[model samples]
Target: MGKSKVYFTNMHATIKENLPQKLRRLIKTAGIGQIDFDRKFTAIKIHFGEPGNLAYLRPNYAKTVADVVKELGGKPFLTDCNTLYVGGRKNALDHLSSAYVNGFSLLSTGCHIIIADGLKGTDEALVPVKNGEYVKEAKIGQAVMDADVFISLSHFKGHESTGFGGTLKNIGMGCGSRAGKMEMHSSGKPHVSHSKCVGCGTCIKNCAHDAITLKDHKATIDHNKCVGCGRCIGVCPMDAVQPASDESNDILNKKIAEYSAAVLYGRPNFHISLVIDVSPYCDCHSENDIPIVPDVGMFASFDPVALDVACADAVNRQSVIKGSILEKNGHKHQDYFTDVSPETNWRVAIDHAVKLNLGNKEYELITI
Candidate 1:
């Protein structure tokens, strides 16, 4: 495959052109208009800031993307699926509340917000993965799969498990339903934490496979009957049920690539990643640490893989911020992400995504 085109524009703004206007120019120059979006439901996948995390992309940027989609005759909506871990966004009602708290209302973004997975994070569509290694069918949010066109507007940042969360991470893990997220993060099924259990019987009532039984005033899971749908993890009031997040980082990365394939295959998709904030942890966290590096710029591409690679390269070239996590880690490895998160290898996702024919690793950065 040939080198894919990745458009870039530095954060520097002039008096004549503001940041939002610049983002509009950047994505349009990156060939966003090439897609046919006439009267189609275009899903602008985004991360609404988790309550108290200030590093997430502002709603103004989402409005810029939505405006461009409207100009192309698409019906646009901002969206994201419920998270697997316990947080402010575990379910739709709380998810919308968090988004509203972060200023993502229809008035701000010029688009409605859709929690891709339904009320309890169970509404999903099973999509069969072609040439899949680990997953046979990927469970994705029903609303994401129902869209005619998909666009990822992601905040590029560090993650404890996956090094840096970029386009692939945004689309793959972010689009997953509760069960799909469970499958990517764990090789084993969830287990009950006996010490934390209050015998509330919530897990027993929620388990569809008859996997739970209360004994000695605590809950126990029958592994033989458990299908690992992850509903118990969400419904437990005491937070006693725990997902075994024991998957190796490499395997977790590859699984993310497969899930991304499930989301983007046979669809018109565009990707944009903002390499700002450079936080040392995911936006899923309620708080964000100081940025590890100076803000780079905004990037857009038709190819998710190349877009991520370009973003990673841009981040690696910056000087580490004093007192940030990267500086404290002492840059042990050549890669800044690895130096920050020694256990993770972000390349695994990029390699697997290439093998899946998502996009070429080689890219031509077009400065607009």
Candidate 2:
């Protein structure tokens, strides 16, 4: 309906205040104090970059947010669900180790880390999506749904599949349990990469539905029996099991919006996105390419959709970095994200989010 307020601050720092201190001021000015956080359990949803990815938001930013929450008497913890793809963060133990390696310790962030979906990524909460078209009940991590308040501390960057990974992508796809991620990414079941499969029978053993069977030292999935729960993908040591990416980017974006609604429904939520680094691919990748554009800044909002739109607009106005992916690809679409990723359309998520009443696309940008 009406324009939501999105607060912004440039990365320029004075001698009086550094980036983290500026971040603290930004959120407070944006009215994070409006929420009564007295003794409430708060989940600060974030991506603790894949092991080698340097594009993720640093732990110092997370500490600034956590410190503010603590000032208001809230108990906050950094949380993220296990990733669907094979990486250092596929399971809880590996995920925590990666977070620590990436400088997200309790000492650094002033908050503990919780792998939302338990040890193996199977633990989940079935959350009903109101007015959902693609998903009726969203499978989110149990711990993420258990929080009294939700805050997304996102690293805004380009994504290969969903156009760009912003607040909605961080909350929707990041909060999903293994099965929930599978549902958002694909309409069908997973298949094994014949070359990578070693016939280790790991997927076969983990599949409760008996959908996977090894034939001649290679695994094959029976889609008829497979329920698409995504358990096999996590259990495969060789990373041979791959989820079908058959869902169109448009449908995938809508599904992500629905999943986000499911996570935030009836909960007090806040969002902050840092548009620095501006990588051409997701932080899920172990290797990050050069930024597509110069760093925009930090943004905070009560509305996730509006926050994303504001960040996208800010990036679109900036000049492209020389020799970066955006420059190499050329600005055919005149949109920074599309110039970097031609196949994706970030607007799909914003439109779907508006339709779901999650947030407004229109926003008033207030410089802090």
Among these predictions, the greatest TM-score belongs to 1
Q: Per-residue lDDT for 156-247 in model 1, tens only?
A: 99998999999999999999999999999998899988999999899899899999999999999998999988889889888788888989
Stretches off by above 4 angstroms in model 2 are none
TM-score of 1: 0.98
Error of 1 at 358 (Å): 0.6
Q: List the residue pairs that clash in candidate 2.
A: none
Work out the TM-score per prediction.
0.98, 0.97
Write one digit per residue (lDDT tens) for candidate 2, span 218-292.
999999999988889888889999888789999999999999999999989999999999999999999999999
What C-alpha lDDT does candidate 2 achieve relative to the native structure? 0.94
